[model samples]
Target: MAANYDYEEAPGSYDDVNRQDLGYDPNFVPDSVKSFVVHLYRHIREKNVYEIHQMYENSFQTLSDRLFKDTPWPSVDAVSHYVDNDQVFCLLYREM
Candidate 1:
């Protein structure tokens, strides 16, 4: 996780969903979640196995626990456009 993203690298606490507030808004997507999805998608697209593993094992759970612990994740229909396949992503997301 440290190699993938350091506290120094993110500019602000916005990307540290596990540790920062990021101004909680149940109706608004947090910046940290947006950034995590983009970075994870980019890593998956590049076929960077190591980074993907790190993000999957470290970042995904952290954000999920911190941000969506008491709520359901947004539907695949809501976020699948960010990825290539809705069906595949839904399975992968369910695992996450």
Candidate 2:
């Protein structure tokens, strides 16, 4: 979960789904997630990652701290087009 993200369950909560499809991998465990956050924060601070200005203006989302609590982890679909895929839909609500 990204610290900057608000964890309230709301209409835009699913926005991360779009980011995941765009290229963000959202399945990292807590350790990896923390490491990623630190790395990204550093990258942002150092302006090492390209197009920082563009990324700064874009909308992004991430999961909440409570996202994994008591939750059965779901697998990413083996073959799914994010634009149009039933598997994505299945994965989204399979555990719920």
Predicted structure with the largest TM-score when compared to the true one: 1
Best model number under lDDT: 1
Q: Tens-digit lDDT track for model 1 on 3-92?
A: 645312443355435334544444355566656666777777788999888888787776676656666555555556666654655577
Tell how far residue 21 is off in model 2, in angstroms: 26
* Candidate 2: tens digits of C-alpha lDDT, residues 3-77: 333222343334444434444344533332333333434455576645333223321122333334333332334
Model 2 error, position 8 (Å): 26
Q: For model 2, what is the C-alpha lDDT against the true structure?
A: 0.36
Clashing pairs in 2: none
- lDDT against the true structure, per candidate, is 0.60, 0.36
**Off by more than 4 A, model 2:** 1-29, 51-96
Query: Scored by Cα lDDT, where does model 1 land?
Result: 0.60
